[model samples]
Target: MNGIEHYRRAEELMEQATATRTNKSGFEVCYVTNEEQERLTRLANVHALLALSAAQADATEFKRELYRANGEELPAAQSAKERAEAKTARNAALAAAFID
Candidate 1:
């Protein structure tokens, strides 16, 4: 699926995960366990990263085209490797948050 579709799916999952109930004493309770919630969040983050990657690629190409058309220099930005490393670090943090 496209990045935006992935992102939308992640949002839907997050909404589903937030579903809660009132306990006997009226305290709010999440339907899913903490581990399950963490897993969902991790998945959502991955989807978000995918969307970012797609959007960045689109933006880079658009900028390149615009610069070429105008005979101007393109602006500097993070390389794909740097972006991938950042995404990896984010994913690692998400995974670590749920570790025992």
Candidate 2:
């Protein structure tokens, strides 16, 4: 597969890992080896790139919405990484059914 395709796949992996991190363990990330953490970080980066490329981002409030959707500020070091993981998760859930 090409680079963008790889990015899409990485985004999927990040989404899955985020779900497991949030739902099953109720932790952002914990108890993973260094290799696993590195992989997860890479996945988050790919998802952020995909999200930005696909996004219209038409409003000023979109920035705040991203944070709210993410559910927290996330750790300082992990902030960007976390936001990207959440970009397409919760807010998209809201946007899909939002009434105009």
TM-score, one value per model: 0.58, 0.29
Instruction: Give candidate 1 regions above 4 Å deviation.
Output: 24-27, 71-100
Candidate 2 lDDT score at position 4 = 59
Residue pairs of candidate 2 with colliding backbone atoms: none
Candidate closest to the true structure, highest lDDT: 1
Which candidate number has the best TM-score?
Answer: 1
How big is the positional error of residue 35 in model 2, measured in Å on the Cα after superposition?
Answer: 0.6
Worst 10 residues of 2 by lDDT: 52-61
lDDT score of model 1?
Answer: 0.86
Q: Per-residue lDDT tens digits of candidate 2, residues 1-100?
A: 4445656777776655554355475756545666776788787787666656545343435766777798966334557778787886888788877954
Instruction: Report the Cα lDDT for candidate 2.
Output: 0.64
Query: How accurate locally is residue 46 in candidate 2, as Cα lDDT from 0 to 100?
Result: 73
Error of 1 at 56 (Å): 0.8
> What number of clashing residue pairs does each candidate have, in the order they appear?
0, 0
Q: Give candidate 2 misplaced runs (Cα > 4 Å).
A: 1-29, 56-100
